[model samples]
Target: MYGVSTYALHSLPLPAALEQIAELTDYVEVMDDGCHYIESAEPLLSYDLRYSIHAPSRSVNIASTLEPIREASVRVIEDCFSIAAEVDADVVVHPGYFAWAADRERAKRQFARSLAHLSAAAEERSVRYAVENMAWEFFFLQTPDELPLPDGAGFALDVGHAHIMGCLPAFLQVPIDHIHIHDNDGTADTHSAIGSGTIDFAAVMATVGQNGITPVIEVEGIDAVRSSISAIRPYL
Candidate 1:
């Protein structure tokens, strides 16, 4: 089955977004940011749809070299894990980035440490999570060579980000536990409708089918979400 992310209705309250998305698909990935930031599963309990959370990414960097910042980032995700546990949902997270070129090695070390902590916490809560590949430079795990995730972490493949980075084909080769599907020109992460951009959705849909994964339509607006669902329906 296919799913939709609340990101398309980010301008609305979480409940409102969920209400609209539920009408379109039985599965939804909550983009926990802005108006949709989830502090508890109480709001989610009302929905009948299956859930996967895109944990809060803004202002959260698990790879920060500063001890407090890195620790705080882990804590933020730990709280998300608590909510996921209550809902029996999986989560999607971004790999942290370094501020300067000189700090890349330090940031990687910090990220590894944070990942270890998160793995243990997730196990405790019985919630699974996948680390997503990023679109820009200075971010960790942007390529397949960065594989063999530390502490047995899972992977969430974002096709738009991978396309922007010019590595979608390589990322598609990796074992993906979760996926975010959207369209974009080869140069930017536009999160456009499925057929509105250059991405070869036929190949993407084929891989998703092979993996038996539900692809989350992570586009820009409610209209784009509808368009994406229509575009991918043929593949589904």
Candidate 2:
């Protein structure tokens, strides 16, 4: 099935945001962030929507070299997983990034450890944990060969991020369990509509469908969400 993220209406209140997209789609990937919280789930539970969650990644890095900070990041993500279990939602998470001075190999090792912790937690709660590829220069899991993908964990393919890294085809070569579909200008994560940028949606959609991966259109704004749906309908 296809869906849209609550991120598409990021500025609105969570319940109102769900209201806006409810008619347009049956699946809704809630973005568990400061702008939208798990507290909104009570109101949403009454709806007929199936859910997934994008765990908060804007401020916390689970792979930080600092022990205390890394632990805190894990705590935050565990909280997100708890929320996901409550909503019966699968989670999409960014494989944490590292600073320029941090030991890249060490950071990668630490990230693997973090994923192990999160994966266990997800398994206990019966929630699917997915690690998303990142677009930034220092992000981890940029290539399929580098992805450990840990036991019980899954891959969340972000087409926009893959485009930014020039690794869309490389990513498609891997097993994708979930997807975040959006367009970008090849230089940034602009979250543009499907046809608004350089990525090839037809091929992307074909691959996603072939793989049986449900895609979350990660666009921002209601208009963009509607436009993207229309642009992608044929692929579905």
| RMSD of candidates 1 onward, in order | 0.8, 1.4
Runs of candidate 1 with Cα error greater than 4 angstroms are: none
Per-residue lDDT of model 1, residues 90-192, tens digit only: 9998889999999999999999999999999999999999999997879998888898698978999999988888888988887899999999888888899
lDDT of 2 at 131: 89
Where model 2 places Cα greater than 4 Å from the true spot, the runs are none
* Positional deviation of residue 133's Cα in model 1 after best superposition, in angstroms: 0.4
What TM-score would every model get versus the actual structure?
A: 0.98, 0.95
* Overall local distance difference test of candidate 1: 0.92
Candidate 2 lDDT (Cα, whole model)? 0.85
Task: List model 2 lDDT by residue over 1-236, tens digit each.
Answer: 68999998888888889998898999999888866867545765878899998888888898888778788898888988887788789899888888965578788777888888998888888898888988787888777787657656798999998999898988887788899999988898899988999998888998898899788999978899989988998887
- lDDT of every model, 2 decimals: 0.92, 0.85
